[model samples]
Target: MSEQKNTYRSIFLWGDKKIRPLEEGVRALVKEQFGLTEADLDQKYLYSDDEVKLDIAPALSEKQLNELQTICGNENVKTDDYNRALHAHGYFFGELLKLRKESIETPPDVVVYPKDEQEIVQLLAFAEKEKLAITPVGGRSSVTRGVETPQGGISLDLSENLNRILEVNEINHTVTVEPGIMGPVLEKHLNKMGYTCGHFPQSFEYSTVGGWVAARGAGQASTGYGKIEDMVLAMHVVTPVGIIQTKDYPASAEAWDLNKTFIGSEGCLGIITQVTLKIRPYRPKNTASASFIFKDFETATLMMRKAMQSEIGVPHLFRISDPVETETAFRINGFVNSMSDKFLKTLGYKNNSRCLMFVSIEGDKNYTLLVKKRMKKLAKKHHGFYIGGSPTKKWLKQRYESAYMRDPLMDAGIMTDTVETAVPWDKLIPLWKAVRTYLESREKSYVMVHISHVYENGANLYFTFLSPMKKGDEVEDYRVYHQGLIDTIHENGGSLSHHHGIGRALAPWMENEMGSTAMGLMQAVKDHLDPKGILNPGNTLGLRSKI
Candidate 1:
């Protein structure tokens, strides 16, 4: 395939030439749920041409392009249609819909790859001087249109060269790294040195450290290891005015926690160059896993809340799936008609009401064992049935691979997307009901929900919904459905987003969610840092600027 075709295809597939086919079981499930026929599955709707040709031309002047080439080398700056198309959008389903139709509405004028922090500083200075917007692109894994250059200036591609593990402070249990490094790369290095960062988002293989920090993301083990904000000790950000570097203090009572300020800035205020993150000893051997089946979602959440508030300990990975998700997972994994399924049925676990909970504890062997025992006891108290570690093992093994399934489903003319939000325990059920009700009200939609990350008082609900694509109206239909879902989430008292940063997808709701005063304060900071509006202009806390 041509480079353009490869680039276009990579947006949906896992890697180059690796399109994971939907399993027969999943295909059957999708057909049944959407009332699709075999012919419908065979009618692939995605663009499969060998060459991706976009009629959009470069918007930058030759003099401006030469200036960028001088700042970085000529080879480091790309103005080709392929590069522009690759950086034009993120992994948002709406963006994918546009790409599937060979549409390029707002392609960046140019893409620049800086080799180091000094180069990034120079690039930002140049962008500021020229009054051009610059959007930082790390891993290109943004699901909220966070990397899109709406004003069409420059895309600073960090994953190209600025990925490196700069320093490892064993004494302080901290690892300082360049922001472009991928999660798997960093984890492999740390694992060889008998350490682990303990942050494993589903996009770990395809996402970058800077993306994680920018998004304020949480991992599967966030329940025990905490979110990226908790792990980030210090960071260096290059803004238009100047570089802001935070000190790596264990704790401080200072007036402003600058690190926290930039943790979820989403590249609106600046570009993150380096980050220092807390690490823990790698102890996978000392891990314990268990699964339970509760009578329903409420009972499962009750047990999870008790486990979290027990004060004894919390598991590293705690997840509870709602009835829909549980049933779907069971079918996809061939759990139906299995021994466990029969056991659950014999124990009076109804089909549409039973929920599944997976628990994983990692630490000292004794501590893990003790926590496992305590969790099991607590589950029993809530009438939960222990189902061994098979469920967790399967989930862990296939967690990252699940992302690739979207490709085949999309090709089969199905639209899939995920939205996540966190809510207090008292409000979780209501919020879940509201969101599900809204989603199900849509025509021919399938909604699956799972509580992924749990805290003492609440948990994060991650919803995956699939529906038949509206053909030429995919993007518009998605916008309407997504807006309604966001509105439903807000009306039900759930946070705008639990981990996915507030990019353009969620920007319109910022003022309503945070109120005008809080947004005004954020705008003040944005204005102070980026007077020229050279940084990411459209999203990030709803601080829009014209460049």
Candidate 2:
């Protein structure tokens, strides 16, 4: 068979082939939100003039290099500067700064593409004997530099030739596929069979199934179908020592499901080669969606909690935005805001001080209507006014675009980033308040928040913040804002992350998040599986001091 062509580009930097320059509407939104003067708009956002200097890569003896090339074809092992540069940075703000400056500190000496699991086994064995580090990459969409290459190692590009579906067991409600398959490609194939994995993280267009499993992602509809961990039944991984494949049975009563242990290993444990994910038939015929406005954040939070407890119906798409986020969403663009303002006036409401909640249910028409009625009643108790589903439809249309908006915002001399965390219901309000208070206190900072992936016990809070660059020190400002939000999340009883994995960006806090004993146990697992520390280091457990 011919090789599968890459339909989408991996890198999304400002001047990359896949990115678009800032549009007028986006520019206007930035100016309005951060009060940027014309000078800020005129600021040319281009690669910094500083030349990227680098130390010579560790020398690989010609004999060893030739053996690696023979193992995986000449074209599969790349040593060019361009390919190595691409593998250096992910979408993290710190990495973006490096890209903007055209400066990469430490990049891989070579990048290797393995055609299949056997090839990966051979590659790992070779690297082990050679004492070379291997960092697994799929789609290269990690926001935390999870795939960053070690000082003198190889970056394994899995998205090249291992992106094919292996099996579709509709009878068993499961689909087995190679880990390198992109999300949209896999979803399209499943849709043809009237099935879906129901994993739709915003990065769906550019991420892969392996990446999803590695990061423990959550789709927008996670309220009903569950997160990636729940959707996975089993996985096939190639660790340094040996292959680790889990049981494919639907439910296992056997000693703790080993599959769950590998779901979010983030390449530290091994390279995930194949995944067997639980699939579901497409949604039913009938559907109902509504947007409601609440008087305050506390009321909206209470209403969502009540809905979670109610047995009327499961909310497949549930979301609630704080007043600040709702207001910013309304004012994101002039034309859009004008249209929404007209609609709000018709309902005798203003965007100010109104938290918005959107809930969608799918099933039979009668049951849909019944659930919506019950939802309305629950909202009414919290003084929430129904605003119909038009707004929700609009939201659905633009949900994925937010991820791409980061480039343009940064282009306009505005530093923009997002951080997410989860907390129990009792601590939810305090966490929300703490994050908002800290961000708003920063100079020129505009912060917005939304709650989603809510469960009976707690919910996830996702925050987006933007601020004008502080003269010539944008990186420092970004560090302050990014670290502040994460620090606040920890102090307020929130997880270090909700969907994003603990890459090097968050590795320092791993011990704090998972106490010393737990962290030590995790390190022990890594040491046992990868005795040579050949896997992705500085990720999860950080550079192994023992090694």
Best by lDDT: 1
Please give, for residues 1-547, the per-residue lDDT of candidate 1 as tens digits. Answer: 2224444665545444366678898989999988888888877687554455668787888999998999889999999888988888888888888777777788888999999888888898888888888999898888888988888899999998989999999999999999899998999999999999999998899899999999899999999999999999999999888899998999999888999889899998899999999999998889999999999999999999988887979998999999999999889878899997888899989789999999999999999999999999999999999989888988999888888888878889898899999999999999999999999999899999999899999999999999998987888888999999999999999999999888888999999999999999999999899888878887656896857
Q: Model 1 — TM-score against the truth? A: 0.97
Off by over 4 Å in 2: 1-26, 47-58, 333-350, 363-367, 543-547
Instruction: Give model 1 RMSD, 1 decimal.
Output: 1.6
Each model's lDDT comes to 0.89, 0.79
Q: What are the per-residue Cα lDDT tens digits for candidate 2 across 1-547?
A: 1211221122435223344555666577667767777677766574343334345563577787788789898989887666777777677877786577665677887888889898899988998898888889997878777877755588898888889999999789999999889988999999888888888888888789999999888999898888899999888999988999997897888898888778778888899999999998775456688899887888899999988887767777899999888876666545335775677657655566678898887656887789889999999888888889878778878877667677656667677788888889999999999999999888778788999798999999998888877767777777777787789889999998889877888887788888888888888888888898888875544536222
Which 10 consecutive residues of model 1 have the lowest summed lDDT? 1-10
Give the CA lDDT, 0 to 100, for residue 425 in model 2. 95
Clashing residue pairs in candidate 2, if any?
none
